[model samples]
Target: MNIKYNLVVLAAFCCTAIGSAQDIVTQEQAVKLALENNYGIKIAKQAVEVAENNTSVLNSGYLPTLTGAAGATYNLDNTEAEFSNGAPPTSLKGAESNRYNASVNLNYTIFDGLGRQYNYKSLKEQYQLSELQARETIENTVLQLFSVYYSVAQLTENLDALQETLEVSKDRLVRAQYQFDYGQNTKLGVLNAEVDINNDSINIISSYQELKNAKRDLNVVLGNALNPEFAVSTAIDFKLQFQKDDLFEKAKTHNVALLQTEKNIAISELDIKSNKSGFLPTIGLSGTYGWNKNNNNGASFVSVSTNTGLSGGLNLSWNLFDGGSTIIKVRNAKVNLETQKLQKENILIGIQRDFENAWEDFENKLKIFNIQQQNIITSQNNFERTQENFKIGQVNSIEFRQAQLNLLNAELSRNQAKYQAKLAELQLLQLSGELLNVDF
Candidate 1:
C-alpha cells in the first residue's frame, strides 16, 4: 500500500512537509548568524586581545626607562665686604646671580635573578589560556544554537502533523454530514465527527503556539533583534561513527577545561620562581648627563661659571633578609603549585568521566533511534490496513481515528528520537572538544 501524504513519512517529509514561505533557515546559516552576532563570543574575543596586550616584553619588565629634567634659578641681593687688616670696606647695591641646569637619566635593571624571564613566560601562558577560554565560549554558544535550531525543526514537524490531522477531521465531518442527510449514517455519527474536529482544531492551535515559542527562543540565541518570529526547514541529518578511544585521545589534547587546568599549573610553577627570586641579588645600571651654567656680578670671585659632565654607574642590591617574608611567600607559592597539580589531575579525571558517559549515551540514543524507525514502520503498516477497512465499512470511525492518531504519534516519536540522538552525538563531540572543528 502507498503511504499517503498525511502519514508524514520521514524521508519524504523533509522534502515537502514544511511551509515554503516560512521556512527561511538552514543549520549552516543559523550557525553563521550566531558566530557573527552573539555578544558572549564578542566579549570573549576582546578578553583574548587584552591578554595579548599583556604579553609584551615591556609589560614583563624587560625594558629600560629614560627621564629628562630642566630648571632655572635667579637671585638678587645687596652685598658688603670688609678687609681683615682694617685697610678698607666695600659695598654693592645691585648684585645678581643666575643658574640654569638640564639633565637626562637612563636606568635599566640588568639582572633580577631570572625573575623577568619567568614572568614573561607566565604572561605567554596567560595569553594562551585566554585563547582556550575564548574557544570554549564559541563552542558552547554554537552548541546551544544547534539545540534550539533542532527544537524549531522538531516543532515544525509536529505542527505539520497536527494540521494534517485537523484537515482529515474536517473531511470526515463533511462526509458524516452528507451521510446523515442521505439517511446513510445516524445523527450520533455526525456529532462524533464534529466533536473530533473541534478537538483537532484545539490540538493544532496548541502545537502552533509551541512552534512559535521555539522559534522565538532560537531567535534570541541567534542574536536577532526584537526576537522576530520565523520558521526553519525540516531538513536534518546526522551520522554516528565515533570511536571511544579516539575521543579520549582528542579530549586529552583538545579539551579546553583540561588545557586550562594544565596552564594554571604552569603559571603556578612560574609563581614559585617569581617568589623565590626575592632571595637573590638585583643588579642595575644607571647613566646621567647634565649641563649647568652660572653668572655672578660684583663678586670677589670668578664672574661666570659653566659645568657639564656625563655620569654612569652600576648598583647592586642583595635582600639578605626581610623578616622571613620571602621565605613565607615561597612556601605559600609552593603549596599553591601543588594545589594546581592536584587540580590538573582532578580535571583530567573529570574529562575522562564525562567522555565515557557521553560516549555511552550517544550509543544508547542511536539504538533508540533505530527502534523508533522500526516502530514507525509498524504503525504505518497498521494505519494503512485500518484506513482500507474504514473505506470498505469493515471498521468503524473510532478505529480509523485511533489508527490515524497512532501514526501521528509514531511520526512524532521518531522525529524526537532522531533529534535526541543528534543531541547526544553533539554532547559527545563537545566533551571531546571536537565541536569547534565541526564545519556543519
Candidate 2:
C-alpha cells in the first residue's frame, strides 16, 4: 500500500509554495543557483574559456607574424680622421655621430613536418578536454547539492514526526490527569505521563538542533552566502528504475573522466608526432623593409648617410643532430601515449566497478524500503491497540510508551530507507553521466 507515503503527505513537498515566512527552494533551483554563484564552477568555466581562446591559428602557428622596430643611437666624442689616401689628418674639438634604423618584418613557416597542423589539432583537443573538466566540476557540485538538500529534507520530515508524537504525549498527559482527579490513577501515573511529556519535549528540542544544522549545510550548498531563512522541498523523485547493462554502456560512452582520458590519449599521440617533426627540415619565408640614417659630425668625408630597402628571403633548416634530445622527446611522447592508454583502461574498469557496487546497493535499498514499509504498518497497528488499551486502564505507562516509541521508530526507519534509496539512484545516474540530463 502507499500508506507509508500518504501518512506524511510530503511526496508533493516540491510543489508546495513557501509559507509567509521564507522562500521554498527546490532541488533544481538549488542547482541553478549554485551554477550561477558557486566559485569553483566559475573558475572551471573560465578555464574552458581560456582553452577556447587558445584554439586559434594565430596562437597555433598557422599564421605569419608581423613586427615593427625602430631605434636611434647618439654619441658625443672628440673626433679625428685619417684619410686612406693620406691627403691629411683632421681633428675637431667635439664630434657628434648618430645612427637610426627601423623595420617592419614578416615571417611565415611554410612547413615543419606538419608540426603546426598537429599543434592546431592538439589545441582543439585541449579545448574539448577543458569543457569536459568543467562538466565534471558541475556534476560534482550538483551531486553535493543533492546530498545536502536531501539531508535537510530528511531532517524536516523527522521534525514533523517528532512534533506529531509530542501532541500524542500531550493528550496522554491530559488523560492521566483526568483519571487521577477521579481517583482512578495514582500520583505515580500522573508523574510518569509528565516525565514522558518532558522527554518528548527534549527529543523535539534535540531534533530542532539537528534540523537547524542541516539547514545551514543546505544554505552553503545553495551558495546562499547570506544564509537567509528558507524552506526546502522534502520530496525527491525515486520512481526511476535503472538497469545494469544500460548504465555500463552509458558510462563508457559519456562518463566525463573516461572521455577526458580518451582525449588525453589522442593529444599524447599528437605530441609524439609533434616531437618527431624535429627531425624534418623546417622551411620558412621572411621579408623585411627598413630605413636608416647616419650623421658623422666634424669628420672629413660624407658626414650624412641614408639607406632604405625592402628585403625578402626563403630559408630551410634541418636539425641533423641534437645530442639525442629529439629522440628522447619522441620516445617520451610515445611513453606518455602508452600511459594515457593505460589510464583510459583503468577509468573504464573503475567506472564499471563503481556501477556494479552502486547498482547492487540501489537494488538492496529498494528491498529494504519494501521491508520497512511492511514493518511500519505492523508498528502503527500495534501502537493503536496499545493506545486504546492504555486509555481504558488495561496497560500501564511503560507499555503505552513502548507502543508510541515503536511507531515512531518505524516512521524514522521508513523515511531513512526512502531517502537512502533516492541517494542510490542519484549516484547511479551520476556514474552514468546522466545526472544533469535526468534532473535538469
Candidate 3:
C-alpha cells in the first residue's frame, strides 16, 4: 500500500509539472527577469552608480570655491603705547582688548600642473569601464538563464518519454497475465512484463524529481518564489549562426571584459603620470574681503574699516627631492601598467583558444545528432520486428525485451544528442560573444 501511494503521488507530480510547464518562456522574459533580480547584475549596476558619483566629485574640483570665516579675539592688556615728553598725556589702561573679524575668501585654480585635467579624464574612463562591467554582467546572466531554461526543457521531454514507456509496460503486463491464465504465455512472461513496468515506474519518478530540482534552480535564477508554478515554453530552440571572423572583429571592439582590461592599462599609465605630475608646480588665484572697527570708551568710537583685496599669481612648487618615494611610485605604476597590458594579451589568447574549442565542440555535436537520428529510425524498425516475432512464438520473450530496451536506449540517445548539440551551440555562441544575437 505504501509503494502504491508513492507511485500515485509520483504520477500526480509528473502531471502537474508537465501541465504547468507547457507554455514556452520568451527570451524577453528571461532577460527582464535577469536584469531585475539577478544578484550579480544588481551589484554591477550599483557599482556603476558609485563610479558615476565619484566622477561627479572629480569634476567639481575644476570649479571655483568660496568659503567664509568668523572669529573673536580677547587681549588681557593693551600692551603697546607711545608718549611725548613735553606734554601731559592721558594714562589709559584696559582690562581687555576685544576684537572681532569676519571674512570671506574665494579661490580658483586658474592653472595647475594639469593634474586636475588628467585626474578628471582618468575618472571618466573609470566610469566607462564600470558601465561596461555592468553590461558584461548582463551578458553573463543571460547565458546562464538560457542554459537552465534549456536544461529544464530537456528534462521535460525525458519525463514524457519515461511516462509513455511506463504505460506501455503496464499494458504489456496485463496482457501477459491474461495469456498465462489461458495457457498461451507462461507465468515467467507475466513476471518479466511486471518487472519492466516496475522499472519504468521507478524511472518516471526519478525523472520527475530531476525536473522538480531543475525548476527550483531556475526559480532562484529568476529571483522568483520557488513554490510558484511556472509554465515555460519548450518550443524555443538554441540556434546560432555567425561568421567567426566577423564575431572576432566585433569582440575586439565590443567585448566588455577585454575593453575593461585595456582600460585598466590606460588608467594605470595615467596613474604614473599623475604621480609624476605631483613633482610639477601648481598655480591658483585667491582673494579676501573683511570688515573691522576699533572702539575705546574713554575716547571716542573709531570708524570701521572695510578691507578688500584680490591677488592672482603663478605659484610653482616642485618636489626638488624626496627619499626615492616618487621614483618608487613611478616605477610601481609603470610596472603595474605593464602587467595589465600583459594580462590583456593573455586574455586575448585565451579568448581565441576558447572560441575555437567551443566552435569545434558545437560542430562535432551537430554531426553526432545527425547520425543518431538515423540510428533511432533503424532501431525502432528492428524492435518492432522482434515484438511481432515474440507474439508469433518465433522468438523468445527475452529476445523481444532486449530488442525493446535497445529501441528505448536508442531513442534516449537520439534525444540527448539533439539537446547536447544545442547546448554546445549555445555555449560556443556565448564564448564568441554572439549569444545575444540569437533570436528566440
Worst 10 residues of 3 by lDDT: 295-304
- Per-residue lDDT of model 2, residues 1-440, tens digit only: 24423322332232132123677787778888889987889999999999999997669887899999999999888877788997688887767789999999999999999898998999999999999999999999888877887877887777777766877877888888898899998888878877776666666666666766887876776666434567788776774555678778988898988989999998999999999899999999999999999987867478898999999999999989999999999999999999999998999889989989988999999899889999999999999999989878898999999999999989888889988998888888888888878754
List TM-score per model, in order.
0.88, 0.91, 0.86
lDDT of 1 by residue, 1-440 (tens): 13322332332333243454454777778888888888888899999999999998769888999999999999887888786777567787888888899999999999998899899999999999999999889989988998988888888788777777766776777877888899988998787877776666566656666776787888888777333545666675674455778779998888888888889889989999988899899999999999999887664567888999999999999989899999999899999989988888888899888988888888888899899899989998998898788767788889989998998888898889888889888888888888867757
**How do these models rank on lDDT, best leading?**
2, 1, 3
Using TM-score, give the best candidate's number.
2
The regions of model 3 sitting more than 4 angstroms off are 1-5, 20-23, 57-60, 73-97, 225-227, 236-238, 251-254, 293-314, 393-395
- Enumerate clash totals for all models, in the order shown: 0, 0, 4
Return the lDDT, model 2, position 191: 80
| lDDT, residue 304, candidate 3 | 35
Question: Where in model 2 is the C-alpha error above 4 Å?
Answer: 1-20, 84-86, 225-227, 239-242
Q: Better model by lDDT, 2 or 3?
A: 2
> What is the RMSD of candidate 2?
5.8
Better of 1 and 3 by lDDT: 1
